[model samples]
Target: MLIAQITDTHIKLPGKLAYKKVDTAAMLKRCVDELLTLDPQPDLILLTGDLVDLGRPAEYDHLKSILAPIRQRIIAIPGNHDDREAMRGAFHAEGYLPTEGKFLQFVVEDYPLRIVGLDTLIPGEGGGELCAERLEWLDRTLAQKPDVPTLVLMHHPPFITGIGHMDKIGLKGSDGFAAVMERHRHVELILCGHLHRTIHAQVGGRPAMTCPSPAHQVALDIDPEAPSCFTMEPPGFMLHWWNGRRLVTHTAVIGSYDGPHPFFDANGKLID
Candidate 1:
């Protein structure tokens, strides 16, 4: 099975720009174009968070329209920029989101891999947290399918990324989340977003990572006092391929570029 991960889209209402510069909707359309053209297309798509810039209903409408070309089921969690109620109403028809919960968390058992999506959104705040309630729910949920290879999807990465500015707004209860992971060894990977750039770390010895956005990326500055900023870096997404036993990941960069150059000629001789 293959899964495509796209995050931090920050789609604003039609014709609006994110941060007064990036055209998130257009970028996302390009990313969607790339996804549609992939061979053996992804069986599923996961939107990690920040699907819109202001958590507005119209933005969700625009986002849905942009994502409409995708035929695969999409499972999305809320990022700090997302409003719980708005997102719930936007995707309620899909039926994965719990109808009466304060948090938008759910587990998907339809595929070969069990997927557990966690809500880390802290409304009107840039930071996120995994409070006791959410942590307990994750623990109990994982326990139910201990033998299944699972994928935990959360909007904020659980480890402190060296990018200090981003780290300050990182997940608050990471230690607790890690403790929960210690008991669920069946989790194959922890997929997260919000960093807007690819980052990887280990939580309770399990691999966890963040995917790049389809739009602007958090500038790669390493100082604690580094001013919060974003860059027009080459945007990308992630693909996780499960071959029955192990899950491998690859980063697929977007945009047209020079490619298909071969190291060998038609006769199989090295090109020199």
Candidate 2:
């Protein structure tokens, strides 16, 4: 099965741009169109937070419209920039998010591979945390299907990326978080999106990745004291495929570029 992950959309109103620079709405539109053209098409979409520029209800409305192209099932979690209530109000039909609590944690049991989402949004804080309630839920949930291959989805990555400024706002409860994962060996991948770039790390002896934004990306500055900034890098999304045993992820970049030219001529001979 194929699962596509889109994150940090940060969609503003219909015509507004993010940070007075990147045209996030247009970028997302392009992303949606790209998603529609994939070969087998994704069976599910994981929207890993920062769906809007502001935590406004209208922003979620705009985000919803921007993401209307994909017809696959979607599961969304909140980022620091999202307002839980607004997201629920806008995407109530998806039914993955919570209805009663401030958290949006959930488990998708229908798929061949079990899917778990952890809500790491600490309201009004740039950095994310796995609070006591969230950690307990994760522990209990993973215990249910210890033998099934699973993917953990969240907004903030528990490990740190070298981008100094962004690292400051990284996940807070990583030590405890790692301990919980160590017990669940079936957890294969931990996917996240707050970093705004394609970053890879290992968490609890498994693969962890941060998906790139469909809009602006955080500058790749490893300087010890770099200021927080964004850039108009090639935007993209992550696609995870479960091949009945293991999970694999691919980065699909979005932009105006060249074609998939024929690598072979007449009889499918290798190109020189």
**In each prediction, how many residue pairs overlap at the backbone (N, C-alpha, C within less than 3 A)?**
0, 0
lDDT of 2 by residue, 1-272 (tens): 99999999998887787878888888889999999888999999989999887889998888888777778888888899998888888888777767788688899888998899898988899899998889999999999989889889999999978788888998989988999989999998999999899989888887899999988889989876889998888999989989997888889998778987888989999889
Per TM-score, the best of the predicted structures is 1
How many angstroms is residue 195 displaced in model 1 relative to the true structure, after the best TM-score fit? 0.4
| True-vs-predicted CA distance for residue 98, candidate 1, Å | 0.4
Please provide TM-scores, in order, for all candidate models, with all chains considered together.
0.99, 0.96
Q: Please list all clashing residue pairs in model 1, or write none if there are none.
A: none
**RMSD, every candidate, angstroms:** 0.7, 1.3
